[model samples]
Structures are given as structure tokens and as C-alpha cells.
Target: MRTLTFFNHKGGVGKTTLTVNVADALADQGLRVLMIDADPQCNLTAFYLDEKKLDALLGESDDADGGTLWSAIKPVVDGKGGIKPVDAYKIKNGLYLCPGDVLLADYEEELPAAWTGSFARKGRDYDVMCALSAAAREMGQRYEVDLVIYDIGPNVGPLNRAILLDSDFFCTPVAADLFSLRALSTVGRAVARWITDWKTVRGLASAESRDKLLHGLPTYLGYVTSAYKVSSGRISTRPHDYWESKIAPRVKNRVVDVLRAVDPTTVPFPSNKLAAIKDFHSLAPQAQEYGLAIGKLRTHVNSGYNAQILEAATEFSGLATIIRKRMGI
Candidate 1:
């Protein structure tokens, strides 16, 4: 099983959209998929289930009973290891989601006491990375997960750090704008630093161990421009074309340069064009009314919606293929 986190330090880059819909697309192909909504916003959860039902699913027990991911994962962190099998978890059919809560924001402040002195050591407390990855691994082993997709928040805090470190790889769904470019660069540096830091702490001596640990480090999966205008089944106008063609290449080159400057082995992933979700205005209204994801909605379908979904799905499918090739899958 492989874990992929869809992330960016920039919000509103369609991170949740890519994570949810891409998982749906993969599920459509009959692959077992698990999506973890690591963001406090829980937007992906909203996309798949109604609020009342979602609350019931998550609120089945009080927080102390290990009802949420925080409680569910604490045992692993405490060294009482082993994840509940995938089938034991609350997943429906081909896909399951580990929803995140606002409480997730508190993890950093509560960094396990053990992590304090470990910074100067040869390796980090395996508990930190292990707790997260091991849970995913165990679930994958149990259910034979084909893919694990994580929808993370827009920060370099402990929660995001843990998610990035745990995932086999990650992709940034960034907007084609200056702020997004800056945020991407910032995240690139953080990722590079974290990878090196964790590796050094691991005290990796054997070439094999070094290879295994570094292998999981996040690599760029290229950029996907969200909310792009479409007309005649293509990006409209020279400005949009320039943004799509020249500007994106230029910024992406700089991002790649930054990553390489920090670590030459860091390579950017191939990217593809994703037209805006068609009639987003209409789709948003419909989603709000019906409590459904535009992609998951069965009624009120339109050509624009179909086109957008297909475009987004195809782009992510191409990304999945590239990633599979990288992992030699």
C-alpha cells in the first residue's frame, strides 16, 4: 500500500477537492482507497457524508474513549502498538476516511514529552513518525489498501509535519498565483529540512536503512492550477494561457530550483492542466442545498460539471501513474 498526502501551505488551492475527488476516481477503478481528512476544516468529510450522519459516526463515543483519530492513534504513540485492521475501521465499500477535528490543532502543544531531548540524538523517537505511518501501514496490510490519500491543512505545524513524514509521497495542489508560489516554496524548504533532520536523527548507518527512510520522503507531484476558466473545451484567453504555459513553467522551475538547491535528489513531479470545476457557482449552490459533493452528486448533472470532473479525474489519474512508476509499482 502507498500513502499520498495532498497538501500545500496555501489554503484554497483545492487541496481537499483533489484529495476527495481523486480518491473517488481511484475507487471508481476498483482500488481500495482510504482518505484521512487531516485538516481541521473537515471539508472532505462534508463532501462525502451529511453533517448529522458524520457527527454520529465521529461522535459514537466521548473523546476519552478513543472515539476520534486522536484517541484512536494515541495507543500506538504510547508504544502499545498495532492499528485496528482496516475492516475494523468505519469505511464504506471501496473507500474509508479518517476524519480530522479542530482538536487536531492542539497536537503541537502536546508534543509527546519524549520528543524534547531527542533532537540532538542520532535519530528521532521512532514513536513520532512510527505512530502515524504504522497505523496507515497496519490498515493497509489488513485491507490491502491500494492507496491512502491524506487531505492536510495549510501549515508546517506538527500535524502537517507528521502527515508529510508518514506518507510515502505527497503532492501540492497549488493555485497559479504569487501567494501560492511563495507558500509552495516555503513548504518545499520545510519538507527538505524535515527529511534531512529526520534522516540524521534516525542515525541511519546501513545503506539499506538510509534508503528505506529516505524513500518515504515527500517528492513534488507537480502543480495543478485550480479554478482555471474554460471555453471551447480549453483554457481561454492569452493571460490564462500565459499563466498555464509560461508562468507556471517559470514558477515551477523556481520551485524545483529551490528544492534541488536544498537537496539535489529532490525532483518535481509531472503536472497536468485541470480546468476549473465547471459552473462552480452552480455546483456550490447545489452542494450546499443537498449536502453532497459536486463530484458525488447524481442529480442536476450538467455538461459543465461532467467536463470539470473528467478533467480533474484525468489529471489525477496521470499523477497516480507517474507516482506508481516512481515507486516501481
Candidate 2:
């Protein structure tokens, strides 16, 4: 199965929004898709369920329950009846989600302790990464999933580290801002470190260990600029000149290239002009009348909102196609 992670170290960059929408879009295209909500905020899961539903899902959570991701992935891997299928709430025609739990954040403190016993057991029956890989593989086998979209949270802790080590390709979604740029650099470096360190731990190295590690590492698909608004000057004007010329190239030169040094196959996602999702204020409720996400508001007064969503969908679809082709999915 092909795994693609939508990640950014900095939050509020629309990582979960894009991941949910892209998974929906891919499902529309008839691809069997599984979205693993790896974020601790559970925002993606919230998008699929309202407050009451979330309460039911979290009924009487204890430390033993896989309410958190680390527990869930293990059972799926071991076939020990540990993993339970998510209910039909978010189940679409060709899409399913493992869903995220808020408890994931708490697991951060417990990861090293949980993993200590297996660290020294070389060639043992199980390792942390193997369990995750096995989970991915088994799920792929069961669902025959064409795509596995991982919606990861901020931070480079054990969870993110494990996901990076197991992912096939990653697409970073960052806001067009300075902090996002810095995060791009940080996450890039962390991914590189995880790859090399994971290889060392996997016992797959030899005299050509460095070369082999590079060969086995996941490809880094470059970042996507999200939540941008177009310039108001003219229809032809691009507001992201700073991003196109300055931010993109700097990341490519400083970060992507270094990762490529370890593995040349690493390539950027489509370098399209930033797909701008115009932020529209939701209209005042007329007697509690509802409307779609703000984009639908523009569809009535003007077609711009629909056009924007379509364009964003198209951009993600292109990235999806590239990822699929690379993974031969």
C-alpha cells in the first residue's frame, strides 16, 4: 500500500482540513482510501462526528483501550483482536478512517518506557516500527486500499518518528509564513535523521550501509502552501511572489537537497502556484438556516468559492496522482 502523510510542524495550517478533503476527493475518484488520523487534537475525527458521537466513541476509556493510536496500531498488526473497526459514521463509499483520539498526546511520555524492552532484542519477533508496518500492511491487505493518508500532528516525538519511518512519501502543508518555513526545515531534518537511524536499528546495513540506507529511505514530496488569499490588484496578479521565489526555492535548496543527498529519488510534489482557499466569513443565520462551509456562500452570490474548492481539489488530486504513480499503486 502507498502511504502519504500530510504533516506540518506548525499547526493551524489546514493539515487536517486538506487531509479530510483530499481523502474525500480521492474516494470520489474511486480509490480505496484509508485516513489514519494521527493527530492528538482529534480535529479530523471531530469533522466526521459531532459532539454526541465523539462521546460515544470515547465511552469509558481506560489505559488498556486502543483509544490512543499506539494501542490501536499494535492490535491491527498482531491480529490479536486488539483493533476494532471504526463505526460507520465516517465510512464513505471507498473511504475509511482509523480516527484520532485526544489521548495520543499523553502517550508521548509513555513511548520510551513502552518500547524499552524491545530495543535490545535484535531479530526478535517484534519491534516498534515493524508492528506499525505490519499494521499498515494488514490493513492494506484487508481493505485493498490504494491510498493510506496519514494526518499527523505537530512535533517530532515517537509517534511522528514511527510514522515517518514507515511512510512511503510525505506532503507537508504549511501556511505561507516564517514559522512555517522554519518548521519545514526542522521536519525535513527530523525525517532525514529518522531514516538513517531507523536503518541502523533495522539491521539491514553492511559495508555499503550508507548507500543501502539511502536507497531504502522514503521520498520527500515537497511542501504545499495552504490558506493563502490572492492579491486584490488584478485578476492576473499572484500574491505569493514571495512564496514562489523566496520560500519555495529556499526550502528546496536548504532542506530538500540535503535529503536528496541521502536519496536521489526524493522529489517535490507539483510545484503549482499556491492553491488559494479564500477565507469567507459564514453568513449570519437566517432563523438558524444552515449552509455548507463558507465556500458554498460564494457559490450563490458568485462562483468564486466553488471555483476555489475545485482548484484546491485539483491541486491535491494532482499530488495524489504523482504519489500513486511513484508508489505504483
Candidate 3:
């Protein structure tokens, strides 16, 4: 299965929201999609599951097989064993979720030591470093999924570094604002470092451990400009238009070109803008409350939201199509 991650160093850019809706849209197109909620905030998990269900899944338990991503990698983090098999929870016909845990944040503490040990070719550190990727791959194989999408926290920390390395492609979800534009440089620099570090790790690692590593860095899929204002079927307001106009050039200069400098042939896509997602307005909160995608909101709501619902469906459907073509799915 091909792996994709929606990431940005800056939060509140609708990263998790894009992940959920895009995965839902892909599933609607009949692809079996597996979503790995690697974010410690657990927003993606909460978007799909209610409080009671989350309690059942994340509550204190002595059982080693707790069915969350944290549980799957806990053994390796504790230096106990390899990843334990954990079943992914089915959200719909073709969509599944590997639930996120607040405790997943604990893995961050071990990463520094793991990274240091990796230089010495310590087998156990390699196991710890590869834990998340290994679990993702095992779950993907078990489910026979067509695609695996990761929902990661907004940061350039060790956890996110490992998660991004495991991905095949990554898309940044950004807002039409200066913060998002500035974050592009942070993301670019971090990814460039991670790619360089991984290459060194692979060269130092034993053949067995090297074989388990991802062969290359995650390619830059593109950026998604989300939550922009729309009026009379066009981007409205001067501030919105001005910032939106600034996004493409900033992305190319700050992100795409930076990656290309690291490895001139890394980016294969022609465009820097993937999709511009209009603000869903009230539809977003309602969909969140009902644990449904905006396009699927119509099934749970009345007739008042028909127009917005159709618009949301069309937007996500078109976004999904672009993603498939870009990924060659």
C-alpha cells in the first residue's frame, strides 16, 4: 500500500480535517483506505469516534493488545519486543482507523537515545526507530489496503520526523496566511535534514536493518490551501485573495525548491497547489459532532444543508481525483 501523510509545522491549518475528508473521499471512490492517527492530540480519532467509544478504546487496561497505535509499538518503546499485532478499527465499508493515543507522545522521549544508538548500528535502536513504520506496514498488509494515510501532529519533533520518514508522499495543508507561509520553510528544512539523516542511518545500519528501512525520502505531493472564504462562487475579500496569491510563490520558493536542492529529482509532480478547500462553515462543526465527513453530512442532516453538502462533496471528490492522479493510484 502507498503511504501518504498530511503535515505542516503550523497547526490550525486544517491538517487533520483534510486528512479525514480526503480519506473519506478516497473511500467513497471504492479504495480501501487505512488511516493511522499518529497525532497525540487524537483529533482524527475523536472526529470518527465519540467519547464513550474513545473511553473503551483508550481506557486503562492491562491487556497488551489494546488495539491502538500506541499499544502496537509500546513493546518496542519499552525495549521489550517487536511491535504487537493490533487490529485497525473499521469506520465504514472501505475506511479503517488505527486509533491514536495521548500516550503516543511518550515515544518522543526515547527517540533521542534511539537516534544516537542508530549511529552505532544498535539493532534494538533500529527496531525502536522503525516501530511505527513496521506497525503501519503490518497493518496495511493485514487489511490489504490500497492506501495508507497518516494524520500527524503539527511539529518538527522526533516523533513527526520518524513518521514522515515512513511515508511515501506528504501533502501540506495550509491556510492563506503568513504563518502558513513561514511554516513552509520550517517544514522544508526539517524534511531535508531528516532525509539526510536517514541516508546516513541506512549507510551505517547492517544489511538486515537497512533492508527494513524505507528506500527513499517521502516525495512532496503538494500543498492544500484550505478554509479560504468564498462569495458569489469566487474567492472573496482582499485579505483572502492577497494571501492566497502569496501561497503558491512562497510554497515554490520555501518548500519545493528547497527539497529540489537536496535532491534535484525528488519532486515528480508538476503543480505546487493540490487543491484549494473552501471553508465548510457550519457544516464542519455539524460533521464533527456527528463524526462524519462533510460530504457524508447530508445523510445525517435535514434538507437545509443540501447546497453546501453538494459543494463539499464536489470539492472533496475533485481533491481525491487530483490525489489519485498525483500518486498514480
Best by lDDT: 3
Candidate 1: count the clashes: 3
Candidates 2 and 3, the one with greater TM-score: 3
- Which should have the higher TM-score, number 1 or number 3? 3
lDDT of 3 at 33: 96
Write down the TM-score for model 3: 0.95
**Candidates in descending lDDT order:** 3, 1, 2
Model 2 clash tally, residue pairs: 0
lDDT (CA) per prediction: 0.60, 0.59, 0.86
State candidate 2's TM-score: 0.75
Residue pairs with colliding backbones in model 2 are none
Query: In model 1, which range of ten residues has the least summed lDDT?
Result: 270-279
Question: Whole-model lDDT, candidate 3?
Answer: 0.86
Q: Give the distance in Å from residue 291's predicted Cα in candidate 3 to where it truly belongs.
A: 1.2
lDDT tens readout by residue for model 3, 220-314: 98988875555457765666567778888888888888889887665788888888888888888898999888988877888899999999899
Between which residue pairs do clashes occur in model 3?
Answer: none
What's the TM-score of each model vs. the native? 0.77, 0.75, 0.95
